[model samples]
Target: MMEFRSVQGSLIEAEAARNRARETRMRRALQRILTAAEGVPGYAPMNWSDVAEVAREALDADRPAGSNR
Candidate 1:
């Protein structure tokens, strides 16, 4: 037999964790993008929106097909 228990915390905690993980992944992706960009000829400066778009694409590409996340 097994027992399940709940710890007291805001329901928002799970969402906060997910957001933190996503931010970490985005940061890593941004670092990789910047590193790769450094080697490109005539590389242009990247704005936050551009970086965000690329990061979102990278994150989406990492997800398995048919996943809602």
Candidate 2:
């Protein structure tokens, strides 16, 4: 029951708020996964930086030499 120009705020502001909520949900789910993984048998914890570096190395190994990007 309102005119288009009478809307709450800019479209971008609404979209950004929506995106922030989605990211919060995603972070919660990811944290739950990590917590559960920590309790699994034979699970070992490492620094996130170490994990990230290892993941990057694995990706690099998967790629062919001289391949751009």
Candidate number achieving the greatest TM-score relative to the actual structure: 1
List the global CA lDDT of all models. Answer: 0.71, 0.60
Which candidate has the highest lDDT of all?
1
lDDT of 2: 0.60
Clashing pairs in 1: none
Displacement of residue 12 (Cα, Å) in model 2 is: 0.6
- Local accuracy of candidate 1 as per-residue lDDT tens digits, 1-69: 122223334446776887788788788887767865675656566677777777788689557699996
lDDT of 2 by residue, 1-69 (tens): 465655655676887887786666556545545765587655555567755654455445435699865
Candidate 1 — worst ten consecutive residues by lDDT sum?
1-10
Deviation (Å) of 31 in candidate 1 = 0.4
Query: In model 2, which residue pairs have backbone atoms overlapping below 3 Å?
Result: none
How displaced is residue 34 in candidate 1, in Å? 0.2
> Which sections of candidate 1 miss by over 4 Å?
1-10, 40-57, 61-69
